[model samples]
Target: MTVEEVVSMVSLIEELEAREAAARVRVEELESQIAELMARLEAERETWSRLRVTRETVAEVVAEMSVPDTAGEPGPEEPAEPAPVRVVGAVMVPHWREGLLVDALPDVYRDIVEVVADASTPMQAKQIVPRIGLPAVTAKIEGTPGKLKRLVERGWLTEDQPGLFALAHRATVESGEGAER
Candidate 1:
């Protein structure tokens, strides 16, 4: 073989090896980036899971608190005890029953019931807002509907038609003339 041809072949082989080494370095960098992104994705998924669990736990606690404990019953001869009062950080209306009174409700909820009971006709949330001592602003008016709906769900109030709230007929009859009015 000619020396010149041999030298040319050796130079071409060295150039190919240099290109291969550069490609390997680029592949390593991309692999590192992929690994980092995977770890970040895992962290985000864990955070999402924790938030969902926390929300579920809070809902469970709130549901359990909705019904006050009535474990100890008084003897028939003993004077009937007054219903236990439920003091809560947030508004919680207990389901109205034969024995439960408006007084058993939290202050805001009782105020809402009293306002509904006193009204001559079924009232809208906007109309009832001012009477409950809240300002007749958009925000206050907007927030009242949820409370009104919750009352209906708990049987303390009724919504025979949409957006019109009234004291439930059964609640009135059970609690006597005051609630009926």
Candidate 2:
């Protein structure tokens, strides 16, 4: 064959090889899809059978509902007192203070934890902020600088660097109070 014809044939061979590779990939994808569809079909069949059984039971119950009541109006033969409601076991512990704390902070802070406990080097509050909560990070970082400085003095937080305050661990702050437990 001529060089041009040979080159053209080589290019066609390469294109055919690429197409065959693509077809193989498509076949694998189709086989996986078939497996998933078969699984779904089996589950659907089981659910349909369950629904049919439920419908049959409901039909029997509906037939029972149509039966005439044995008792008409009872002429003052019934007892006067109604039954008392019953609750079982260690039913509830009403921690009102914890409820107030939870209400004070929007729920998002539940996820947020400012890790100030036992690290060789202190961490920045900004990095710790994302670790703490979703509601708003402002609980650890908010308000005017003067007020914030006062909060820092009050030991609510410890500034690791400028514009960065690591939340003082609750245990450290609560240690002085009898509520420390």
Local lDDT at 121 for model 2: 51
Number of clashes recorded per candidate: 0, 5
**For residues 23-84, what per-residue lDDT tens digits would candidate 1 score against the true structure?**
99999999999999989978986786677556644643685565445567856864455454
Which candidate leads in lDDT?
A: 1
How does model 2 fare in lDDT? 0.46
Per-candidate alpha-carbon RMSD to the true structure: 14.3, 19.8
TM-score of 2: 0.35
List ranges where model 1 is wrong by over 4 Å: 1-61, 65-88, 170-181
lDDT of candidate 2 over 19-39, digit per residue (tens):
999999999999999999999
Cα distance off (Å), candidate 1, residue 40 = 30
